[model samples]
Target: MKKDITIPVITDVYVAVVNEYNDIYKTQDWNAYIINDKDVDLDMVIIVTDGYSEKKMTSVFRKKLDVLPKKSYAKIELMQEDLFALNNRFKVSFFEGNTMYDKTYVFRKNTINLKALQNIPLMEAKGVLVK
Candidate 1:
């Protein structure tokens, strides 16, 4: 099989575990974000834990993004309880221009610095894309 190329300009990826409060549900929600940059449109975006299996660490989050438009990004909330942890591997797969591309990101709990967390709302609200 041929290997797909990684396009750096296509999308800037960000992974984070956030604490969100649901007004409707009246409960605290922990979510993970798979933010993509706005430069390129991404399709079939799938985020999964590396070394995933039925027995251990089998968490997969999939989304079909027809287009992640430029100057804009997408946020995917992970359902998994434990989002921030060491040795957590996240594999992101998507399609760009008919070519399927994928990359694996390892989390070390310190993945998102304190400064980055403060900017999450700005990023989400203002379409601020960061890497």
Candidate 2:
């Protein structure tokens, strides 16, 4: 029975953390973005995010979008510097046409620092990408 079920593979979609200037606070803040690199659009996009560690955890945050167009990206959340000490996770789910797909991406504790920043697809800003 298990062999009969086909699980779709998720590709070209990713969650990243970028450092950007905040207009309101006039500060450089760490922000999360959902990047869609596929040729098709993603519908009913839902992302649940949280940060945790050995003895502590942050509140879970949920963000929804009607659609994410092809080769584009959307901002999900702003992460504080303190949360960088915890392992941050992003569970993303969406529909590509009639099929639904989901995947979890994680940024391990203490690994989101400046050294990890690199070229991200479809975005000029460099950031840490989950493989």
Top model number, lDDT: 2
lDDT score for candidate 1 against the true structure: 0.54
Q: Rate the local accuracy (lDDT) of all candidates.
A: 0.54, 0.93
- Give one digit per residue, the lDDT tens place, for model 2 in 11-129: 99999898877799899888899999999999999999999999999999999999999999999998888998999999999999999998999999998888888988899898888
The CA lDDT at 48 in model 2 is 98
Taking all chains together, the TM-score of candidate 2 against the true structure is: 0.96
Write down the TM-score for model 1.
0.58
User: Which segments of candidate 2 are over 4 A away from where they belong?
Assistant: none
Off by over 4 Å in 1: 1-11, 50-66, 79-86, 109-116, 125-131
Total clashing pairs for each candidate:
1, 0
Backbone clashes, candidate 1? 1
lDDT string for model 1 (14-95, tens) is 6555556668889866555666554666677776654232344544545556665544445565334443333456677777
